[model samples]
Target: MRTLALRGGARVAVVEAEWTDAFGVVTRGRVQLELRDGEPGPVLERDAGFWLRGTGVRALRNPGRRTARVRIVTPRTRTVTCPLPNTWRNEMSSMNDSGVVARTSHTSRLRGLAGIGFIAALAAMVATTLAAALARAVGVDFEIPDGGETIPLPGFAVVTGFFSVVGIVIAAALLRWSARPAERFVWTAVSLTAISLVPPLLSGAATATITALLGLHLVPAAVMIPTLARSLRTRTD
Candidate 1:
């Protein structure tokens, strides 16, 4: 019997010599399987049992911002202990000093993400507002037929900020549970941005209004998506 501990964002290659016939059970946090071709496989949550033999799994990765452990059982009677590297040992020792270390580390990561999201939201708000003002200056009337009222400049900022925060929330959720968070976030954000264009087209507004609306929608999406995706990559990778 042995225990394999993985720190947050840690990846350990599977050595056939050592892992042969060894069965592993996840004891804490989440672990993502890395396939032979470097693609991601399924994530195993707590209490999940798995066998890596003949599975073509290249590595085990801890996807969450906390330590994860796996209990390994072999057919042999002798016990084995896999020692962590010095850096990992130091980290583990600090974590052992206080139970709150893991929680604090997780919270600190989220707080950094929140800071990045706030800056991106503010930039998006300013960008969309400026773009709207520019469109109006160029004779693109900010009218929507559904509301029968002109969309104000401040309205542009408000809408942009709201949607940007939504993107931030999505990014945070992905960071918490996803193995390839940045890639997934980009795909999701881009698809939603594409969907958002449909409403402006069906609004029965003039060509210029629809055009401006579509561009405005894209402006904020452009601002928020890359920013959040980059931040997620930095944190997860």
Candidate 2:
């Protein structure tokens, strides 16, 4: 058995002949499988073992910020030891005929996306709060006829901040699990925005109040939906 250390974002092309009868276990960090057809396969975390025989796995890539290591065990007759850099080059050249290439994104990109998403959420909250304040100044009392209580400015800020953070969470989840995260996030956020409008229309408030509430709902959605979708596309790396 020999260990292969891969730097973050490093890729190793797989040569079927060389890897025949070999099994590998992820000993550190994470490794993502890149299929022969250029599509992504499963991501194997630490302790995951896999065999490449008869599988269309084209390459293994390090998908985290730190280095990843894989322990490979081959048949006793085929066991060999060599410097990793030279071994990687030899394997890559051997697979030249099959045109297998590695494809993966780094973890740092995902972390950057999270940072940007949080900032966007804060900006959306501020914009929504300002919009509420402007509406109040224009004679929208923001009063609910049901209980005769006026919506406070602080309430607007608090609710907008809370829901904006919720949008960030949904976007982050989609980024982690969805294959087409940007498109899926857009669809989900738009659906939620549409649903939010119903509550205002059913609040039994004055027409001006209902309109202001509807606009407030849209204000945050407008800021968040596009921002998160754009970030998702970029951080997909």
Say which candidate scores most in lDDT: 1
lDDT values for all models: 0.80, 0.77
Q: What is the lDDT of candidate 1?
A: 0.80
Candidate 2, 128-211: lDDT as tens digits: 889999999999999998879999988987888888888888887877765556789999999999999999999999999999
* Best-matching candidate per TM-score: 1
Which portions of model 2 miss their true places by more than 4 Å? 1-51, 54-107
TM-score of each: 0.64, 0.63
Colliding residue pairs in candidate 1: none
lDDT of 1 by residue, 207-226 (tens): 99999999999999988998
Candidate 1 TM-score to native: 0.64
